[model samples]
Target: MATESARSERAGGVSSLRGLAGGGVFLPGDEEYDRARTTWALAVDLRPAAVAFPTSAAEVAAVVRAAASAGLRVAPVGTGHNAHPLGDLTDSVLLRMSGMSRIDIDPDARRARVEAGALWLPVIEAAAAHGLSALHGSSPDTGVVGYSLGGGVGWYGRALGLAANSVTAVELVTADGSLTRVDAEHEPELFWAVRGGGGANFGVVTTIEFTLYPIETAYAGMLVWDLRDAHRVLSRWARWAADAPDAVTTSYRHLQYPPIPEIPEPFRGRQLVIVDGAVLADDAEAERILAPLRDLGPELDTFGRVPAATLARLHMDPEQPTPGGGQSALLDELPPAAVDRLVEVAGADSGSSLFLAAELRQLGGALGRSQPGAGAVARLDGQFQLITGGMMVGEFAKQTVADCERVVDAMAPYSRGRQYLNFQEEAVDPSTGYDASTWDALLRLRKNADPAGLFQANHEIPHR
Candidate 1:
């Protein structure tokens, strides 16, 4: 993809895209260029030919129309959370919906109508006001539409279906530059495809309406352990997670916290074991169920009643920007043997600072329950998803892909031959991400919806 400056040069040396509605178009030299193009990953750098910050769906439609008429491409972005810096769009028109932030909660119907730019925090806060909750991302800072497009899996995924499953309707700008509303009752096929097809394949999503659940506060937090016991902690978590009840969801992560004053003293500058536990129910029930795991010798136990507003901080994920790499796979089962094998590869003994964090999130339960028109969701029936990610550096920097594969091979005995789209690192063969049946269906849908292959730059899917 060409940069905005390069694209504009080709377009008669014009800086702003003409005929765009409402707001002024941002060109190459604009002061907002840098801030507008940055994403959460710090890896993705997008220099669009122009950025149209549409305040209304009509303005968005205008930008799409102009781009289509000028033979330019449009890639929608939401706070750039899912973006990878290397995924450049030099000649494209980046349609940023960040200015379109709006949240409308219909408590009576237990639903929320969200604009494409609304982050999970707003939705959670809005729903909390009505004693309702949505299947939002573990990190509330993540974009709602982007997460859903990648098949939203959250802390409560075991009890409720994916965030994608909660979608009731969407307003999209299709390939031909038409703004259309899609639902189970309207344009059902497209609706099915967009449920989890990944974004920008079919069109630009402007607004989305999704179902909400009644959950104000629950028992959720992490139990941290010293790196010395990483092996024991990892092994124990594996078995305990396998038999965990539906209401109890947890993920095991081995992380190296930077030596920063903001970081707690116990966790700062050390390889620590953290078990993220969430119970979307009353405190007593959660405490009883989590007691066994809690007794497993944690250095610091932060598990207790906490406000939902502070949920994002519990994970303590990196807030700073840096280039990184990651990979993930679904497991059919994690028996005692499988747990032992995983401990060998990713445990404390696994001599790889390259492995910043490896997480094992328990899957299945409500996630396995099929919903109408679900498309390309990752590991619905799997028992767990094994994921690893870290900053790309030194020899390890160039070997992210190989390391990811190495992790996968080490755990192959328990893997179910399924992959999670979000956790996929660059250089991963696309066909491996989806099962054969899913790959075939995705190809057929791609041929039907985007025969021109305009969105191929963002992802790889064989289109005849």
Candidate 2:
């Protein structure tokens, strides 16, 4: 392996990286370097020593070997949605895998083989054509491999469980430049580690195979009410969520829309409380399940039988790149008192400075139960998930960091003292995302898989 001096010498140029087979190498001064290094989260500005786009798993291995020879680490990025947590990348090689986006759906087997670079949108569309659906997150644009490896929680999560749990196999390039396939029957430990321990920790994943559900349509949509009813809506949601069946997955958001043309006319420059979710049942069953909330008389109700492909847009997440700050936490429960506390801090009358969207996602059902021989993060022990974020624009950008912390601080009492790895915006202890046993097992497995410490990027598991 190359030494520190060798790495420093190679940092000035990308000639060695360019010599690699089956990939594109980009240096700081390269024409595409800036665009290649840009991420979905506009807040992240990365300046890596080099950026490489590998077309195949063999090419990925070649890049890994090259980086090892240059005494540099590799940070594999897909769609770059979680780039903010990666911190500095000066000494690393950013591996851009968006070029290998290929999805093969096996409707007979009820599974989809997704390449690392594939996004959820294409996969969802492909599955929908076969009247099937994968456990995909809210945003269709999010990368599949990254989201699945980090324990994806989607609109159908309550019914089908996490996306990570659905993964049946993974193909990756190990630290020694060897391409390996892992699954329950092969490399079982590594399979467990990658499922929810966070990808890019033990190796660079090239593709993943996950199971899909047989469903063409379901009852899904959003219900909106003026901010005046924030407390009442939230309280009802909390109570409903507690006893909600496995068929329903829901969340409530307190939104403060900016006075911008991008926002809808009625919602722009206003504070609104919205309840959004999906029920994996027919219209009649869904209506029965959602009858209580419907009886509350929302100002706007859009619930109806919708195609599974359309579920991704229910949250109304920005389809284009966005600049924002985000923070999240897993909560033990959202009791009445906790609901009051949240409304007091993030409600319309709260005069809050940083939060543009504050939400509490219902957690339970399949998410609360661990499957036999599950992955690293077997189950989420919490009852609800709290997420708060703000658009980072102009003055708000500077205050976002502090404001995020302030919200987290205020909600500390109800926190489970844990966080979801995918939603974390900063580097946090891996222990926070797992139990003691799982954390320890992950550390041991990471060390064994990447003994040279070649792959250490965002939310990395320390070798020691």
Candidate 3:
């Protein structure tokens, strides 16, 4: 039963959203309001004042103005893949960008420009049509604007650096409901801040552009072993990742699959360890670089050349909305002691109830070097970014969170206490995602651009 005051508030949200040029708006009590507020991370139940689907940059600006007029803040979202931290939106308008998906590729120039709502799969396929590829993350359906803005680490991360540095330009709606474009030459400060600093900290991005590589295909795949080999396999991967050339980037993971009919035979209800990635080289060269790990004897090897576009789905990340939760940390180094601790906590005998125990990305190489005129977050100052994830549903949701945090806490000694905001599903101090100097500069810029705090972000950088 809705209270009289609550009904009035919902009515106000609807009335203020009138005259939207494209798409529509939904307020509480509306038939579609519940569906509109659902995020990719299904566990997060967002109860915003209202939800708006804006189609164009102009429409986005109008939504912002409407929210302001209605005495509410505006929060922009693409796929809501990392929506866990956006705790309270009761006083805000949830701006869903799904209606604005548009992708454009210039094959000759090896560049791509996409609307804020676009997913990486479409962009990658479009780019691949011209015999090129973009720096996309593991999940093909991830929103390009959000991932690139928050610093994307993918199969080719070590070689190409972050997806943020590759971003060429951004078009957004600012606090005052103005559609503005920023690049290296205009609004350079905001441009720099949004690249790796997370766009919502400033405003709602309408479109974005980034570099595409001249790549058709390469030797890329995974090497799988049973969970019992986690200790030995991960140990080798850590050492290999530390000294391996930048031409190749990889991750070591411990995966536990549920024993269900939907799962395939090989991985169904099985506990396993896998090392997967891409090698930007010919078959022989890639094989040679992977020889050390191959010698260790993997039960299954799926390394070979394939179409560049296929790389988007290499990691087998979910393509649909799923109930999940996770935690992550940037580690300085993973010495033998750290490795032992990780295996002890999440290994086969640990009795941990989690889907993915550890997904440690190999950092350094180009990712460690700061580029000239790069964004606020130039490089990740750590050797590895450790991630832990699990399904958050039913009676196990609380246990899942505790399990993920336990792994992070166990490896705390080796961590630099920093974070890769892209992989972070829960909220933490946004400053931990950037350097001390970078955080300070970002705050100053936020203070100038949005003094009234009219915009809300998942990992908000507090200006006040």
Candidate 4:
């Protein structure tokens, strides 16, 4: 089915796309083009010259070769959660990888092999079936590959560290259009780069293999308080998290539920404060650890033992795709002044219209320490990852962006001036996501592997 790009001598450099055998291609004028280019972030409008869905490795290779041959860059995406930064895809072939969703669990070895498009939900469930679990983030639908590439911080992050470091091997289609397998032994440097340095700078990853843990369950749930109690709750949580034991990981959030029919009546249009996470300890020990927060008397406390798979949906992130934008910053320990600034910006009386005003995920434990043979992101350099954002589809889009920025900027006094790439939506200096030496190594490797600049990543590591 030749469309505008192919018919017009492959304008935008998407020539010879007919070679994609396993999946289909949608050009600029095709009816499916809009739908194909749509990412999980509906707010991000991506009108690339072409969008290709490749089901197998061979097809990915074909698309890569075709785009490179025609002087087009290939931008591979799964759910497109972080697609906002890949602006102006006029000469880019958007290789949508969702068609290649596949998962294979090796219970004996406690490992799983998943395709680029696989979401964290199925992988979480699969691992749980064998009395194991993967370090998946709050949202189940997040693409595993993209999350890991950007340094994944999940409910288990404090204890287990970032998900990228758990990767064992990666199979990708490189610039030369060759299907290459990289691991600690084979293409070690490339393997290191892909795990945390961002794969888009080198190739379109087809599959990823990662190690799983023997976690069948943990003491996990949420503690909720009325919006009026946000200042107290946040202050208490900030102190508790600073020296919180490594056996637990938690996040504090100020959530404003919308008064929409889709939402349940209990929380509809209600503003509240929430602190939730998992505790990797026995019942008595967990109880002892949570005593300080419990003393504050939350309106709701459901922290108890549950099956590991349940942790995937514990955070209650919107299951479906929604139009939203957010801002995040890595922060040092927050003093009383920082807490005051946060309350001033996003609290109940702050005129903030965001659904999720502010979230501070406790970081330390394994996350603060670099392990042997770690990837590009050796360790998260801050004690807490602060994020604030809201839905942006309606007339409040401008307000939402401004409100989010206000919260982040107000807390700048405590910021580490670093980037947690997974939570960063806007264009930031990529080097902020890494240190000095790691950035230079990744750049040199990218130039050698992709001299012609064949691939485009959301947070691109520029070769030139």
Candidate 5:
């Protein structure tokens, strides 16, 4: 429950927001408040004093002003994919941008101007019509703004680099309620920060323009094997991935599919090991590269040529909202011995409490090369990434967190002592994702742009 003084302040804020155009505001007890505050991860419950659904930059500015007038801070969210780190919002106003989804494709220029609320699904479909694709994550439902702003790693990252490198411009509504257009040539400092410094640290992004690739289709799909073959398969995968070309990006996972009506018949209630990825090459070339794995003769093989849009579903990620928790680490290497250790702990025979997935993604190639004028998080320095996650429900949720920590601890010797911001499930030191100089630069930029500390609840960058 809010104190009397806090409630009074929120009531004043709601009054100011009611007069705004191009958007709707919901108060704490309003019928739409709960639905408006709902995020992609159901485990995060945000109880803000008010929620604003802004349809345009002007409307977003109005909401920010309303929050200021009521003596509260503002927290802008797209699909709220990383909401767990946002500790508390009782005195904050959530600027929900889901109502402003829009995408404009300039095929001739090989660029797409995407709205803050838009997901990668529409952008992928639209770009495919022009034989083009964006550097998008595995899940198509993830918000474009948040992903790119946090150094997005996707199926094409090995070849094209992090998604933040592809961003060209951003239209943002800053702290003082001023809408500004920033890029390399305009507000270069702010542009650099917004690219991979995390979007919320600056302001609410209204639109972003990014470079796209000319790719209509790619050789991509998944290969599954029974849990009994985990040791051999995972060890072989590690060796193969070490020498794989830049054109190929791959990940191997140990999955436990629950016996639920929503799950597919083949994967339902089954424990399996799977390898899936994308190859930016012709079918013949892809087969030549994948022949070694094919020789393993897995029980299920679905690898083949597929539309670029289909890459979104290749990882079998949940398409709808689901309650889950996850932890990630960047690894210096994944040798055969390390692979064996992973299998010993999370394999089907291990009786692991984690109920969903544990994965290792091969990373190198273009992702390790620094480009001129790249984002704050220019490139990843590690060779592999380890991710462990499970559904958050009942006692299993507690066990899942502990099991994930144990996995990380077991693999500590191979870890690079670094983490990716987008994959982080809990609040951590901002410096964990960047080097000393980069962290200092980010803090200085944060102090300059958000002096009043408007956006401080979500992955905040501390002021110097």
Candidate 6:
């Protein structure tokens, strides 16, 4: 079905990529091309002309050079966990980093250096092996570089700050196919842009070096309640978390689990309210600190001590692809009145989606402190990030997004006028997601570093 001219153009692009290191390119007609281009977000259907699995940073540079010469857009792909709201690549040269998977933990330095292609699972497992833990996102399946680059916020964010703040160094391949190392001491401008600025705005990160902490165990998990108690639970949770220590982070969701055999009978196909949370720094103090929450009436309680590797199960975010839409806002505060209003909009009584998950992460503590000389990672200081997401398909996608915005707009009173980069579902103007000053600062850095606009992927910060 290809036009002769278009076919010729693609052939030319394919030919130019053939000699680039690690392996040959995956062209459109190739049998494995479709499988290789699939992203974790089921809704994203990528149609890249080619996918290049670079074995090294030099090879990544080579791919960028070839794309530049062929006038093709370049994108970086890691664990493909671009989550809903973040657009995926189309008709671009996907510089898939899967081949670059590598992780090294320096016990003495209490730091870990990982390739851009690696997922957080390996990092958590590796860190746990040494009785240490890295500041990673909720899902262990998320790519470290991809998440950290977007200022990853996890259960420990309040205690440790966004994951990007823990990064010490980055090795990136820029627009001109040149390699550059960024950190507080080197390429300070690019360093600022890469931290929490989102991906594709700067360059393709090859590897990242970040600090890790020593944490052996914590009290974590969730409690499930019937939909009838959703309003009451929401109000109680709002008040309890307001005074919660930085060590604790929690989120509540109004969900209707499908009646599948995989789902427990008690929760199957039933509307329910569940609280998922974690206590990061202390095990003994967790019980006393979280007692107020635990005392709230709930049908089921599953909290207990757990290792970091199994933390992803706490939220139990589906691993497989599902059609969904999501939107997010950074919250300045969450009071009981605000929670009551939120319940009015998306609670069990609302005949919207069968599932609606609203997360509230406690902020302050280390999250409010700036990492000295952290360049870009130091820009984030949001008090709390609120996200409302749902799984919907086909014609309902638009309705879902609209429904989400209603909740977002209704909660504007408590918002910080910022959005979480990861939860964004649409192609948003880069300026709207960050604080005005933060956006301006990122723009200044992008202008100086990735002035050519080469790397563009999830939640992209375009070259100005």
Tens digit of per-residue lDDT, candidate 2, span 181-279? 999999999999999987799999999999999988989999999988999998888899999999999989988887889899968888899999999
Better of 1 and 4 by TM-score: 4
Q: Whole-model lDDT, candidate 5?
A: 0.86
Candidate 3: list runs displaced more than 4 Å: 1-14, 19-23
lDDT of 6 by residue, 65-118 (tens): 888787577888786666343343444687788788899999889999999889
Of candidate 5, the 10-residue stretch with the lowest lDDT total is 14-23
Off by over 4 Å in 4: 1-15, 19-23, 354-356
Q: How well does each candidate superpose onto the true structure, as a TM-score?
A: 0.89, 0.96, 0.97, 0.97, 0.96, 0.91
Candidate 6 stretches greater than 4 Å from native: 1-11, 19-21, 83-91, 281-284, 377-382, 395-399
lDDT of 4 by residue, 1-464 (tens): 44665535557456467547454888888788888889999999998878899999999998888887776789999899888889888778999888888999999999999999999999999899899999899999999999987788988888999999998899999999999999999999998898788888899999999999999989999998888898898888889999989999999988899899987776789998889999999989999999999988998999999998999899988887889888899998888888888888888888998575689999999998999988898799999999988988888788889899889999898986988888998888898898899999999999988988889998989887
Candidate 6 overall lDDT versus native = 0.76
Scored by CA lDDT, what does every candidate get?
0.73, 0.87, 0.89, 0.88, 0.86, 0.76
In order, what is each prediction's RMSD in angstroms?
3.3, 1.9, 2.3, 2.8, 2.0, 3.0
Give the TM-score comparing model 6 with the true structure, all chains together. Answer: 0.91
Residues 17-86, candidate 5, lDDT per residue (tens digit)?
A: 7656354788778788899899888888889877888888888888887788777778888888888888
Q: Name every residue pair that clashes in candidate 5.
A: none
Better of 4 and 5 by lDDT: 4
Poorest stretch of ten by lDDT in candidate 6: 82-91
Checking candidate 4 for backbone clashes, the offending pairs are none
What C-alpha lDDT, on a 0 to 100 scale, does residue 119 get in candidate 3?
93
